[model samples]
Target: PAASEGLPRPIAGIGRPVTAQEIAGWDVDVRGDGEGLPPGRGSVKEGEELFVQQCASCHGDFGEGLERWPALIGGRGSLNTDQPRRTVGSFWPYAPPVFDYIRRAMPYATPMSLSNEQAYALTAYVLHLNELLPEDAELDAEKLKSIRMPNRDGFVPEARPDTPDEACMSSCRQGRPVAVTMDSRRFVQPGSGSGFSEPQ
Candidate 1:
């Protein structure tokens, strides 16, 4: 008899393979173009109610945000200011991701607890708070994708050499590079020849 005949199979039967249903449950991501959005619809009014119940504690009743929490509304036209207030209306370039974020991680204390319809409603209510949607508006995957964000055109392709789109190893600059250096002797103490002085 072969020595291998007495040994157990090489495959370890510790855990079972993941089922398709499990994969579907974990693959709940909505794309920017509205792909993968679950079949559901939610009205702004419904969303308002859901937001008040599930989101108002941290995000405030109108999405202004409580202490230390981020605001979801306003900040429109403030991106160019010294104290820029980045919010959903001022910074987000797409709308579908909003629903995706709310669905996956929201209400802080209990994430992924809300149903798809509830997520949609909360998204609609947030849009309403941003003044992007009417109080009577209803949001589904189709309408959500159609609604353009205020900063839809705000993002541009990165031009830096370190970025993937413009990565380069040599000759990246348009002109001669200038070297910036500080005088090390200036940092030395007057009585100490080589030792550097501590900053006051």
Candidate 2:
């Protein structure tokens, strides 16, 4: 059969569609608790090398963040103050999310290009730099999830309406409502009286 005869015509309004494989290639995302982490591992030494070559330009050689690129370490205990400076070693709740974010989008321009092992190494290196992990440690998906953050316990659980017996109106007071007043000057009067000329 001829090619045109064998294949159906494209949809009228549809353009070229993307394949599932293509989408999946760009959809790499690791969740907390290592849900979507790829099978790979990285060591602190490997991460330091990659960081110097790929990250040191924007972020300082020591992960201090060049100019305003954002520091990858330090800022511990800063979140307790009114004006907090958050960093990987400080306010982040989970360590796995950091690896996931880096793997998905990093190196600024070339995002989602690093291998799973490279990502793990970078995560380990950054954690070590921040003093969150030991220097000789290796980071894989499993251990990444297990790494607890200092600020993890600082955040409080979201407060929601409790059961009728436990609920207290005084403890959870809803704000008072405001009344709206219409101003005549805001609208324009129509010359021909056609709905006030839509208020010029």
Candidate 3:
């Protein structure tokens, strides 16, 4: 006999299996099309208050980022620069991801204690600081995901062919070899016979 046949129908997933009530856990994803947002709302002002108390020590007052810390605003278009660039407004593509990241990891010392209301408020404040939304904007779960970033269109799917083809290597632009004009002897000592020479 099959092992599952002898078990209870509900436990065995046979006919009319038992079901549990779908507990409405906090799965507030808030997609870009304004989905999964809770009914609550918040503004930048309230976010600033929360930020000053919970944040700012590490993130900076203007979101400029403290010593070796993450900046929360600005840097609209400097991704290609040699220096480090940051800001939720510039680097991040989706607002929902920002909210998700913040909810998952934020306030440095403390993690995941901010209520949903406070998270929405802080999200609004960051958006306001980055000029993505107005300071008085009341960010609810619906509107938060719709906010787009400056570099949204900057990325594209990688279209380059994979390796081992050896077709991607460029031409060696350094033209044909020429006579060495510089004296190698002068560069080194008069009688240095060792294979490798040490830098002065």
Candidate 4:
């Protein structure tokens, strides 16, 4: 006899299958290759206005970022430096995701509040701030996908060797393990209650 022969049947009307329309509403993600971008257009000028109104509080007027907030512009050649500034221009490899992120989560206090046009405009404005787009540039799905970020070729494929299929029960290390200590005092601020005083 089948397993279901002795088991209780599934209860009917427990819940309905998810509808296509509901799934469509939640399927708003845009891919790096510009797939799933909604039909909308926005200019850098319009983006600037929207940025000042909605994003300046956290990202700053020029995408310079506020205190404790992230900076969006500059950092063109600092990726290899000791203090790398990972901004939209210096780090991001694609553009469509910019619009995706803004449309899905932004304005800090409010998420998913911007319309498609507004999201495009904001993406254009941020690109302009990073010197990736001209002042009069307008962006739509196609245009956004066509844009090649500065760091588009920065990333490389994973080259590290994969682990063996069989796990090692013991004797994994070939050398003695070295213990490294990190001084947290340098990271603590003078008045942050860490009790570590900075040298004058």
Top lDDT model: 4
Q: In model 4, which residue pairs have backbone atoms overlapping below 3 Å?
A: none
**Candidate 1's error at 113, in angstroms?**
0.2
Model 3 pairs whose backbones collide: none
**Distance (Å) between predicted and true CA of 155, model 3?**
2.1
Error in Å for residue 48 of model 4:
0.6
Q: In candidate 3, residue 195 scores what lDDT?
A: 52
Q: For candidate 3, lDDT tens digit of each residue in 39-94?
A: 77778999999988888988888788889788888776678887647678778777
- Model 2 residue 176 CA deviation (Å) reads 23
Look at candidate 2 and tell me the lDDT of residue 5. 89
Candidate 1, residues 106-133, lDDT tens digits: the string is 8788898989999888999999999889
Evaluate residue 27 in candidate 2 and report its C-alpha lDDT on the 0 to 100 scale.
Answer: 66
- For all candidates in order, the CA lDDT equals 0.89, 0.83, 0.75, 0.91
RMSD, candidate 1, Å = 10.4
How accurate locally is residue 136 in candidate 3, as Cα lDDT from 0 to 100?
76
Report residue 65 deviation for candidate 2 (angstroms).
1.3
User: TM per model?
Assistant: 0.72, 0.66, 0.66, 0.75
Model 1 ranges off by over 4 Å: 1-18, 162-200
Off by over 4 Å in 2: 1-24, 157-200
